[model samples]
Every structure is written in C-alpha cells, then in structure tokens.
Target: MSDPYGPPPSDPQEPQGTPYGNQPYGQQPSGQQPYGTQPYNQQPYGQQPPGQPPYQQPYGGSGPSNPDERTWGGAAHWSALIGAFVALAFLGPLLVMLVKGNQSAYVRAQAVESLNFQLSILIYGIVSFVLAFVLIGFLLLPIVGLIWLVFTIIGSVKASNGELYRYPLTIRMVS
Candidate 1:
C-alpha cells in the first residue's frame, strides 16, 4: 500500500522545517532576536519571578491570599457553634484545625481560638451539670450556655470580617 503521508521530502539540501511558526535554528527571518537574548533591562511581561522575596509581600507568600481564604478561616471560627448545640463543642473547630490549620496562619489562629473556647465551655458545662444536683446548679448551667452562645457569635463576626478574635473566656487548653 502507498504511504498516506506521500513519502518524505526528497531534497537533500532543502532544510526540513515546521509548518508552524518556528523557522528552525540559525535561520530566524530578518528581525527577531533568538530565544533568551532579551535586552538586559527588559522585565518579563507579567509577574516578577520569585527570588529575594519582594520586601513588600507579607505573610511569607507571593502576596496575601485572596479574601476567599480569609472567609474560610472565619467560617471555621463560626462552625464551633454547630458543635455546641450538638453537645460536642470541640468537634467542628478541632476538625478544621487538624485539616486546614497548616494552610494559613489566620485560619490556624481562628481554629485554635475556637477550639480553646469550646474546650473551656465543655469544662464549664460539665461543672455546671454536676452542680445542677445542688440548688444553684440550674442557674449556672443556663448562664454558661448563654455566654457560650453569645461569645461564639461575636468571635464568628470578628473572624468573618477578617479581624483577629480571641475568645474572652477561653482558657487556652489546646493553645
């Protein structure tokens, strides 16, 4: 059978070349400089290369992460309330801290703060529950719950707004 590609070019000295834009080595048509020979002072077209770390970029990255990252951190702070109502106040924040803590400092800080607060509330709740057997226990349990709810809401708001939030009553058990 005949080759569908019509055999190859037969000219021994005609110089093989790409049908695409490339014009082969040492034979660039008229004006263009060869690759990598850009003028010494010319900067690349977009995005400066990574080296010496720009004095201006903060947070040890090319630049601060986008706002969406901050939102995720904030959400982590708020999610602790879900655990609170479910009787596992540390689950949400603990999971977030374990899963995403290393990704961004802001997220890690929020997660840690939430976890600490939840743990403190857990301790307080246990104490209040045991004390409920006594005359004063009933009042303290409800008050603790109210305080937890209010503080969690405040922390969530501050985090969502990209502000640092430290739980006022947190005891730093997890640090």
Candidate 2:
C-alpha cells in the first residue's frame, strides 16, 4: 500500500516534463524577455513612463491642494457667523484657525483674517455699547453689525473660491 503522506503517483500516459510544467526554472515563456532586464518602454525613476501623462502637483504645493482644504478655508471665514450668534464673534474663527491653521497656509491666512476682523468688530461693539449712555452707541452698534455681516460674507465667498481674502479694516493683531 502507498503511504498516505507520500506524493501521488504520476500517470504513465502523461509525458515527462519539468517540475514547473514544460518550462524549466528561471526561464520565461516564449516571446517574453528574461528576468532582471528592464522593459523596452520603461522609464527611469522620477520620470513619466512612456505613453503616460506627466503628474501635476496640486496648487504648486503651496495653496490648497484639494477640495477639503478649500472648504476649510471658507469655513474659517463662515465660522464667525456662528460665534456672532453667541456674542463671541471671534470664537468661531479662532477655533478654526487653531485646528486647521497648521495644515494649510490658505486656511491659516483666511482664519487669521476672519479672526482679526471679528476681534475688531468686538471692540467696536463694546465701544458702541458704552456709548449707548450718550444715545449714539445705539446707532453705532447697528453699523458695526452691518459691517461685520458684509465683510464676513465677502471673505467666505473669496475663500470658497480658493482665493486668499484680507478683511478691510482688520487690525492684524494675531498676524
């Protein structure tokens, strides 16, 4: 009796061949080049391969490279609206700047611009409130709110388009 663990017996009707079928070890099939040789159309490292288009670096490696970055940039400006609802006009931009600023320069610049503008608005609002004792603060407060809305909208639109926006009258305190 044959051993259970032993190899199966070869069929007598089959023709004898190498262990790897008809081809021997280290040999390629017919019409194919041997191993260790580069293909005829292969290009060197860091080069565009034959028949392939060259790769384009996104935003020249400086600006926002993808849609997410652009979204974040726009968010940095739009976030101030949320903060404004809570009477903390700088909080939204400040949070966005702190979280995403280091990842992209575009977002950082937008956030900084929004944060500075919000801060300036905060100061204006405070002065307006104090001056309300003289009755003029009431007028100044509405004007400050109008200015904040207009500039924040402009900044958001520009940033959404992947453009860096600088708010007019920003104090640039954070830089």
List candidate 1 segments past 4 Å from native: 1-64
Per lDDT, the best of the predicted structures is: 2
User: What lDDT would each prediction earn against the true structure?
Assistant: 0.76, 0.83
Lowest lDDT 10-residue stretch of candidate 1: 55-64
- Candidate 1, residues 71-123: lDDT per residue as tens digits? 76677777887775787878888888888777776777778888888889989
User: Best candidate, TM-score-wise?
Assistant: 2
Candidate 1 CA-lDDT value: 0.76
Tell me, what's the RMSD of every candidate?
Answer: 15.5, 16.3
TM-score of each: 0.61, 0.63
